[model samples]
Target: MDKRDLVIRPIRAEDIGAVQDFLFTQLQELFAQDGQAAITDDVWGLGKTYLEPDNCNMWAVFTPEGTVVGTAAICAYNGRIELLKGRYHLPTTAEVGRCYIDAKLRRQGIGSKLVEAMTQFCKDHGYRTMYLHTHHFLPGGFNFWQKQGFAITIDQGGSLEIVHMEKIL
Candidate 1:
């Protein structure tokens, strides 16, 4: 089906299983090319937990007929509260991750829509800043994040060079 027949919306509770399946499929495809070291149980667990509305914010892209086609999540983090001090030190910050669109629907604007939706979600959730990390090797990921106004904060070498980017909300 054409991507134009799709709609994007907040993830519903009933959609969790489908979202997870989509996520696993995408991850498997990624690993098939990059190798298994890139996949981790922790990452899988985190994705599952992040779908819970109370724990994290997520958005799902679905076909007009109701099939989920993409998913994104904003995992929050705060750098201010000195754990030793037990006090707040800085504004809330969030890390955007688990952004995956069905391979067939890529380049059809679904990815950008998901990012924009997540950014709005972060803003509504009171996040003062948002950050995400992408590898330099993922075809167009680095450039795409840059186009979206995410500044590169770090670059580490490997088959995949980690590139961190952030924007203040």
Candidate 2:
């Protein structure tokens, strides 16, 4: 895909539906299993969790025709930081989440662009590090984040091996 054909920017209010549909269609199994209650808990709270905060945001990559092809987001890291048993300071960290690209658009640098935008946003807003977790289940998941400079902090080697990674800005 030609780089010039895509537009990457912070998501606007009007782009919410396209983002939801794009993500739902891409990861139907996860969302459908819960009857999409996850969307209501997360995507539906975008305004309070992302848009309205100075250190949080959600970005979307749009085609010229205005379809959402990719997305990335940063939100305040919540929960117990001590659970990871790492030297992480929660106040200086932002959680990187909701990163996905259209299946047809992979390997064309769209995901990297979205991550770049998120990292730059994190840097500008005074976040010292970005954190994320991924499992082996998603295609290209570990390699993608590793390429973006995130180092694996923990690899739970059990039935459900979730990998937690972090990148310092």
Best-fitting candidate, scored by TM-score: 2
Q: Give the TM-score of candidate 2.
A: 0.87
| Alpha-carbon local distance difference test for all models | 0.73, 0.81
C-alpha lDDT of residue 123 in model 2:
89
Count clashing residue pairs in model 2: 0
Alpha-carbon runs more than 4 Å astray in model 2: 29-40, 80-82
Residues 145-165, model 2: lDDT tens digits: 999999998887554457989
Top candidate when judged by lDDT against the true structure: 2
lDDT of 1: 0.73
lDDT tens readout by residue for model 1, 26-139:
777765575644544534564466765453777889888787788788866645323212222235677787788877787778889988988887888787778777887666
TM-score of each: 0.81, 0.87
In model 2, what are the clashing residue pairs, if there are any? Answer: none
